[model samples]
Target chain A: MYRYDEFDHAFVQTRVAQFREQVEARLAGQLTEEEFRPLRLMNGLYLQLHAYMLRIAIPYGTLSARQMRQLAFITDRFDRGSAHFTTRQNLQLNWPKLIETPDILAALAEVEMHGIQTSGNCIRNVTSDQYAGVAADEIEDPRPTGELIRQWSTDHPEFSFLPRKFKIAVTGAAMDRAAVAAHDIGIRVVRNDAGEVGYRIYVGGGLGRTPMLARLVREFLPKDDLIAYLEAIMRVYNLFGRRDNKYKARVKILMHEAGTETVKRMVEEEFARLPRAAINVDPAELARIEAYFAPPAYEALGDEPALLAAARQADAGFDAFARANVVAHKQPGYAIVNISLKPIGGAPGDATSAQMRAVADLSERYGFGEIRVTHAQNLVLPDVRQRDLPALYRELLAAGLGDANAGLITDIIACPGMDYCSLATARSIPIAKAIAQRFANPARQQLIGELGIKISGCINACGHHHLGGIGILGLEKGGEESYQITLGGDPGNDAAIGKLLGPGLAGDDVPDAIERIVDLYLAGREAGETFVAAYRRLGHDHFKGALNADRH
Target chain B: MPIVTERGFGPDGWATVADETAVADGGDVIVSWKRFVAEAATLTGRAGRIGVAVGPDFDVDLHVAGLDGVALVAIAFAKFADGRGFSIARRLRDRGFAGTIRAVGPLIAEQAPMAFACGIDEIAIPDDLAARQPESRWLRAVELRAAVSYQRGYRTGASVFDQRSTGGAA
Candidate 1:
């Protein structure tokens, strides 16, 4: 919802022209492949298996209806009629040719969008809780702060060429919906006892080959000093983050080696030495940024749940959807509706261009024209009137988005694995598709409710398997694809890294392993306890018993 | 006296020996370590339009002020990704150094607009690349958005010791 300022417009324009020349030079053979690789990557263009893939930044996942249309248009024109909505809240078109890249960039820029910093060994597209502003339990709307960091990190001269790629996610909710616990810098928005909103800083947590849950660096960082404080943290990481091995270059490793106490001391000492002017966060500017994320227009009405419950009594599907997908909105008479991108057995979060347009239009009609993409790979129409839920559900069902599996077992978060990502060692989407088919039973799904099945193609953890209660990692052993299952992972207030159960399982056996985990959860989980809590109480030994019962 | 064999010039072109006095004065002019701090005043403006190329080594504001009235061509040093010169060029422009702030470096083609975006009005590439590469053609693609991006750091306190030295002048 942030508008392009003079600074933002100018910066992107310069970058487009800069990349334009680089592309021309590469085509003309003036620059070698090695030289052009990083340059194009910095602009968010990657030469993939088939053609060039342009990963465009969604800017903390805030996009207008028109912007969504533009994405749809780009997909229909340049890509193969569908674009992939990534876990980072960006869209990647698989077939954008090298020749069509500049045009794609130009088209994106026309709408105040760009692909800068979505790739390369630099700071990446900042992720935020999709329900950031409208979350009922939020301390503050974290998007404006996210926008500020987005600007500060874009084409940043010093840290753009870092030891490795860096990612940052922010969440206003005490729930930590943005998965901040797994980012290089996960900022949780918090309010002090004095009622002033600030941040609880978590540093060094990341999901790659080596997954480390971020340690809390500060209890409360004043809103004004967010950037300044972050600067201190990054300086510590930039200087000390391992450069010898690319795999170990993440700040998480550095924070691990140095420990939270040492890092906290270094950050504080460095922050003090930093000129106050350099770290200066003007209150007025902060207020101005806040203006961009102004609160939604709330309408007061009497009991919507009563009316919705009456409507739901007539329809079973509506009742099921209401039970699963629909969440209580902060405002009265409104509900936050989660339209599942995961159709039964379909790839998780893979929305067709047409589907995106449908969601964009539905957003305008039922809720405000604001759609949010959650970390679970589901889209939320955050402010739907309860009166409109039945109507919206009907419309979404027609559009193939009303899957009613918001947090159900079928609401799986799987990475693009070998299908798209070069880093993936195995195919993740097929496994996810297969699992969805197996758990396709709606009653069975509802019975085994609140279960998380996250799949990563490899140990790189792009699919965030490390955070899923039933984590699945796809790996290749010998000539065949295999999977390793982890249990009790989470991305909430009590964030904890997933514990590995045992050795890897064959690809065909993954779904069975998942079934066994769910069966155990269904059997042993106490009344109303979720998989995570059950696993917490039962520990790895209980899950180990379940996994040992299954064989290829 | 260390022999001063200069390679680049004023208006950000190639440096040349103007005359016999240029040789005597220039031979001792070891451009390295000639910050205004070490050398005394009065003799500072003796070198004709001689400005120190601003890298991380020297502050442009200080060097420009000491060499008052001497036009300083902000040399980019290299056209391919050596961006320190843009900082030099921006600082020179911000500090009201009315001198010709030209970018002279290797791989100077198509970077003219980027140079201009950072406030460089003049550019001088390596003679060989310059001969083969048409720098004027790069001007046709003038950018609409222009901001002086010299001291933009990832973290505000992102210096060597976590102390921020970002946005040195602004």
Candidate 2:
């Protein structure tokens, strides 16, 4: 994990002081609520339905034990005793009072964290693979790139007030855990034929009322030209992106309106005009950031220790957990343990203060003192030893963190919808809960196998419903909550937006409709085929009748 | 309207003429983009220095060639949230405009640093906004944000990239 240097510390503190003054001005009536809204939003403060929601950026989803503890302390002190981990790998405190937000920010800054650029129409928190350096298929660690972007985009003079919010995600691994396709800018770290590391840049991808997958603007961008090229793209968007309609203000709409080739030409022209030598960071600076993400010290050991196998054989629960929650690591004798926050019938990503503290302690005791928040609304211990699986599993069980459903149907991604969000037109948490309860049986979930059911309460798509294997979007139709289903959306290399299935159904009819679709998939799938793969093979026509079961 | 520059509040040096207003002689005057383009032949040899007030949608590339003797370029922000003016300033500087760049709008004091960094030499704010947020607030904002910035190529004493490359404070 990256530690805050003196400069980083001072930067965050200064921002905190700046925000403190802004809050005072707002309270003193020197600044109107309309004027203060953007300032507060830039600091990641939002006025939700019930209270102020302060979102804290967990840069690249990596957190040290100390930082996790600080988050727990903040949750206990200012907010209710829990926090929700967003799909962007950030955390949201839903109950923080507006007056106490500055204090909360100061506390976060103490742990090398702040809420800057987590919201508002600026370059948001740069996200990358949760398993950046540890993943087996990585070409290069992307945290350094993400960090460089973080520094460059922080209070960026030229891009602070963009036409609309901009999101940039980077993925170093071939697997694309960060869902780079559904971002405003997506960078995939790749190596050229000559073995020189570069980037495959994608632009214009976003999901909101209008969902768009990014187009490849640059096939190969040298690593050194990263910042300069990004500046060119942002400059082009800031100048030309539409501002008349807020819905059509994203960079995607610009790329869609102005053809990709035209946007590319504009970006290349801008890139040519920019002073690249001065804009790009020095190689030594990149190397300095990269050093922080080097592989941790590991003992000399072979793969899959004997004890792990024996423990799995002895307990069915342990066997299920190892099969679902654990993933292979690049280093030997290590496994990436995903602690699912999507417990059956519970809110998708809410973690109690006790759960947070326990996970922090487990990170210190079992692995290195580091934790990762996954984009799927889960927590990851990226360096857990295979030998410690049993003990770690038992401790996780005691803390209610031992859910053996990582990519299963029960592990759903949902937004804090009508329960707290002012923008929500329908409730999402209840839908997610109902679906999870429907598939609560472990054997049934294993049979369903690797199906993602994402639910969003509104068209804002905060839960990333468009990327789910079974995408469920909630809307208000005819004065009743309606759920619409989309199938075959994948967030990986073969990224595609899901196709909408028939007409929308009532809220109570959603789970049964999902079950019908799953039944069709099970009956149609070939041997060892995942839901998305089967959907591709069987096509949308095969599952079109599933939603119409009740219509007849 | 009050103008805010690097040296706090400054006196307005030019008169802004509407598109329909007559261009008087013997004083610096700013005019709309429409007037600049329509009367470029006559305004070039006029007695007064000419400045152009452009909207957020103004394309500097299309008009940069005609701005040879222009003394100032005033970019307007129809709304404070409309940021196209910032890009307009950057483009003017990129096109080798050696004259003063002014931003005119209802921008808050907190936006002073960004406006200055984007090559705006001064900001002419609406009277209502100037009354609410005085010059002291704007000066404090600029001073506080001038301490450190990671971006390069802009006017800043402390560039994080430069500091890292030169082995200054981390």
User: Whose TM-score is greatest here?
Assistant: 2
What interface RMSD do all candidates show, one decimal each?
Answer: 8.9, 1.4
Model 2's i-RMS, to one decimal, reads 1.4
Candidate 2 Cα misplacement greater than 4 A, ranges: none
lDDT of 2 by residue, B106-163 (tens): 9998888999998899999988888888788898889878877888777666688778
Model 1 local distance difference test score:
0.73
For model 2 the local lDDT of residue B42 reads 89
Q: Model 1 off-target regions past 4 Å?
A: A549-552, B1-145, B148-170
Each prediction's TM-score versus the true structure = 0.82, 0.99
Q: Highest lDDT: give the candidate number.
A: 2
Candidate 2, A99-188: lDDT as tens digits: 999999999999999999999999999999988889999999999999999999999888988999999999999899999999999999
lDDT of 1 by residue, A459-531 (tens): 8887899999888998888877878888888988788889889888877777787888888777888999998
